[model samples]
Structure formats: structure tokens, C-alpha cells
Target: MIMPRKGGKEAHDEMHKANPNLKVIFMSGYTADAIHESFGLIARVPFLSKPFGPSSLARKVREVLDTQ
Candidate 1:
């Protein structure tokens, strides 16, 4: 059981304000649709569902890194 001091979007927003070029890949146990509805985030944001293996993570990182 893990506890977070701040929400992922809040932390990301703060970091993004400091660095506009920062790329993010959100990882959560919840589904993408659920996250979008709850967080009010756009569909363009990258996301990774939980239980992903190294390969999937690597691919997602590469994809985000390659995005404009």
C-alpha cells in the first residue's frame, strides 16, 4: 500500500510549468478512459497501465521521447 503526498497531475503540472519541454508518461492501475474522465486531461497525453513489463515501459518511453 503506497501513499502519495500529491496527485500525479498536480506534480506534473508544477514540473511542466518549470520546464515546458518535459515529456511525461502517466502510469496507473486505472484505465485510460477513467483517468481522462477524472483528471480532465486530453487524449494526447501518454499513459501506461499498470503491470507493464520492461519492454512495454521502454517502448512507451521511446514513444514519448520521440513525440513533438
Candidate 2:
């Protein structure tokens, strides 16, 4: 997961360029729509909003892992 303060999309793009098969689960305080709109991440990438509990985090992680 990447938590870039700025240039988040660029960072993600670079990572993907380096390793296209890398699985990423973006976590942010912003809503998923906001992140998607801002980053142009229209792809079905997994996302987790901030302020989540341990179980929530765990569940999201598992979901991402399972899909990959």
C-alpha cells in the first residue's frame, strides 16, 4: 500500500511501470470517489479509507489478497 502525501498517482504509476503485476491496495483519508477522481484511477483497484478498525483493515487486506 502506498500513502503518498503528494504525487500519489505518479508514484503508483511508477510502481506499476516497474512491476505491472504488483498488487496494490491504496489507503487514504479521502473517499474512494475523491481518490479515483483525483488520481484518474478508474480501474477496479482495491481501496481502503482511513480511520478503519483493525478488523476492517484485516478484512480489506484479505479481500485484496484473495482477488489477486
Candidate 3:
């Protein structure tokens, strides 16, 4: 998982370029909608917002893991 700022997306892209099968889950303080609206990247990766509860985090991780 990564934060989409300060070259985060660049690094993620580089990793994906090296390994197309890489599964990424982006975490941000911003809401998913905000991230999508601002960066137009919701279609590219799974995301989890900050201040989430353990259950939410676990569920998201499980969802990503299952998909990948």
C-alpha cells in the first residue's frame, strides 16, 4: 500500500512497470471519492482512507488480496 503523494504514484508505476502483477492498495488521509476526483486514479487501484478502524482495514486488505 502507498500514499499517493510525494512521488508515490511514480514509485508505484515504476514497480508495476517492473512487475505488472503487483497488487497495490493506496492509503490516504483523503476520502476515496476525493482521491478519485483529484487524481482520477480509482480505476487504477484499490484504496483505503486514513483513521479507519481495524475491521475496515482488514476487510479492505482481504478484498484486495482476494482480487489479486
- Each prediction's total of clashing residue pairs, residues at least 3 apart in sequence or on different chains, is 0, 0, 0
Candidates 2 and 3, the one with greater TM-score: 2
**What are the TM-scores, per candidate, against the unseen true structure?**
0.91, 0.81, 0.75
lDDT of 1 by residue, 18-64 (tens): 99999999889999899887888799999998989999999999999
Candidate 2 Cα outliers beyond 4 Å, as residue runs? 1-6
Query: On a 0 to 100 scale, what is the lDDT of residue 47 in model 1?
Result: 93
Per-residue lDDT over 1-68 for candidate 3, one digit per residue giving the tens place of the 0 to 100 score:
34456455777779989999988878888888877777667565888888889999889888988984
**Model 1 ranges off by over 4 Å:** 1-3
RMSD of 2: 2.6
Give the local distance difference test score of model 1.
Answer: 0.88
| Tens-digit per-residue lDDT, 1-68, candidate 2 | 34546477778789999998887878899999988988889759888898889999889888887885
- Least well predicted 10-residue stretch by lDDT in candidate 1: 1-10
Report lDDT (Cα) of residue 10, candidate 2: 78
Clashes of 2: 0
lDDT of 3: 0.78
**Candidate 1's error at 3, in angstroms?**
5.2
